[model samples]
Target: MLEFALLVTALMFGGTTLYSFGFAAFVFTALPAETAGPLIRRAFPYFYLFVLATSAVAAILLIARDPISSASMGVIAVTTVFARQVLMPAINAATDSGDKSRFKRLHTLSVVITLAHIGCAAFVIIRLAGQS
Candidate 1:
């Protein structure tokens, strides 16, 4: 279970890091802006869900072996919930309402939250590797 937890945590870390750093940029560069924007917006929910589920399970599995790591994962999971459920809809609403400033602000918030999640997942992975 510990090994599985570590694998999941590593996956979360790698997935987010890769997507944010490379894939998203490649996507926008390759696709038309109108198409890419909506496509990325559509993909965000699935990305958040992956973070939420993986982090939640990793936290549960880490609780006995490493309480602090577990708590960090929990924080990531909770933040993802907010990013997915609350912030996302608000962002979409701002876009629909043609409020460019509001959309940018909300989008920035979402990006920060995702980066924080990636950082937390990386911390957990480092801690786990140290234990190995």
Candidate 2:
């Protein structure tokens, strides 16, 4: 079970890291903003869903062995729900309405939320896998 929890936590960490640093970066550099923006917007829902589901599963798996990690995953899951349901739509609306300030504010919030989730996942993985 610990091994399985570690795997799931690693999956959560790896997927977010790859998407944030790898896929998103590649998309923006490879395509024009006009092309990349919409493509990423289309993909965000799926990404949020992936985070939410994976973190929720990790939370359950870690609940017995590591309550702290489990709670961290739980927070990641709940926060992701807010990101998907509320923050995402507001950001879209801000973009559509040409509200640069609003978009900046909301987008920054989203970035912070994503980074926090990644940090939490990383911490959990390190704690579960090994001290080193």
Candidate 3:
């Protein structure tokens, strides 16, 4: 029962991370610069605040629950790293674009971060599946 609960929690966290990433990517890539300009300008403050809130809450939950097993820890670690190191940077880069070179550099960094995030998620998911 406890294992099942832990698995469910892990899956939920993983899904949340994926969902957030998907939304950010879609907003960044699909929306045109002009179209996204106002939207991003208006939304960024709220979005960042929300991200911070979520991160704090998640950290509290993880610390409290303190996943005893290795697999659980892996899931938490991967998701947390991806959120902080990858997704946040990607979103920031996507929102702030001024110069061509700056945009190019940020875009490249975002891609790299995204790919790393996906790889980490895949690895964690596979590990979780193997445990089941």
Candidate 4:
């Protein structure tokens, strides 16, 4: 049961990570700036909520099952999710509404942080995968 729970948590985090990457790719590549604003506005809130809920559940499951092995991953997962899903979008939204320079700076920072989060998630997933 513990293994199963861990696997489920991993899958949730992995799936959310993939989904976020796909969305980020779309924002970076296909979408025009005009469309990007509207698209992000429409999509980000729901995505944020989804990530938050999933990460929360994953963390709870991890803590309930095995604290030592899973807790680190859970912490990383939660942090990544919060940054990608909550903080970035909020910053982006603020930038969109405010000064161009500020927007660019915030966007750049968000992108770098988000990429780092993805890397962290990937590392956690790989490590946990081997363990389980």
Candidate 5:
């Protein structure tokens, strides 16, 4: 159980890091904003879903052995729901409506939330790892 939890938590960290730094960065650099923008918008949903599923699973797995890690994962899972369902649509609407300021603010919030999720996943991994 511990090993499986660690693996899932690592997947959470790696997925976020890769999507945020690797895929998102590469897409923007390799493609123009007009092209990259829509592509990233499409890709983000999957990213959020990944965060949600993995964190939820990890939370369930860690609940008995490590409440702290489980709680962190739970927070990540819950925040991801808001990010995916409410926040993402708002960002898209802001962009579609040409509300640049609103888009920027919302997009920044999304980025921060994702980064914090990454931190939480990392923390959980570190904490759980020390158990063995």
Candidate 6:
């Protein structure tokens, strides 16, 4: 179970890092703006869903052995839910309405949430690795 948790945490960390740094960048760089923007927008919900599922499972797995790590994973799961359900729609509304300021603020919040999730996943992995 511990090993399962560790593996999931590592995969979550890698997925976020790669999507943020590699895959998203590659998409934007390789594709035209009209194509890339909508493509990324379409992908964001799935990305959030992935984060939510993995984090929730990791949280459940760690709850028995490490409360601290489990709590962090729980936070990631909850925040991803918020990002997917609330923030993403708000962001789209802002964009659709031509509310540039609102869009920027919401987008920044989304980015910060994603970064925090990534950091927490990395922390959980490091903590688990040190234990064994």
Give residue 131's lDDT in candidate 1 (0 to 100). 88
Model 4 CA deviation exceeding 4 Å by range: 73-93
lDDT of 1 by residue, 19-107 (tens): 89888898899999899889988898898888889899999999999999999999999988998899999999998899999999999
Put down candidate 6 lDDT per residue, 43-107, tens digits, no spaces. Answer: 99989888888999999999989999999999999999999999999998998898999999999
Model 5 Cα lDDT, one tens digit per residue, 4-117 = 999999999999999999999999999999999999999999999999999999999999999989999999999999999999999999999999999999999999998999
lDDT tens digits by residue: candidate 2, 1-132: 888888888898999999999999999999999999999999999999999999999999889888999999999999999999999999999999999999999999999999999999999998987732
Name the regions of candidate 1 deviating beyond 4 angstroms.
none
Model 3 agreement with the true structure over 1-132: per-residue lDDT tens digits: 334534444554455565447666577688996776566556544543443444344334444344333334344445555555665566566556445576667656545644544454355445445655
The lowest-lDDT stretch of 10 consecutive residues in candidate 3 is: 64-73
Give the TM-scores of the predictions, in the order they appear.
0.95, 0.96, 0.45, 0.66, 0.98, 0.96
Per-model lDDT: 0.90, 0.94, 0.50, 0.62, 0.95, 0.92
| Model 4 lDDT tens row, 86-132 | 67766766766786776777767656754554565466556556766
Better of 3 and 5 by lDDT: 5
Residue 125 lDDT in model 2?
92
Candidate 6 TM-score versus the reference: 0.96
- Model 4 RMSD vs true structure: 3.4
Model 5 segments beyond 4 Å from truth? none
Clashes within 3 Å, all models in order: 0, 0, 0, 0, 0, 0
Return the top candidate by lDDT.
5
Pitting candidate 3 against candidate 4, the one with the higher lDDT is 4
| Pairs with steric clashes in candidate 6 | none
Best-first order by lDDT: 5, 2, 6, 1, 4, 3
On TM-score, the stronger of 2 and 4 is 2
> Which of 5 and 6 is ahead in TM-score?
5
lDDT of candidate 4?
0.62
Which of 1 and 5 is the better model by TM-score? Answer: 5
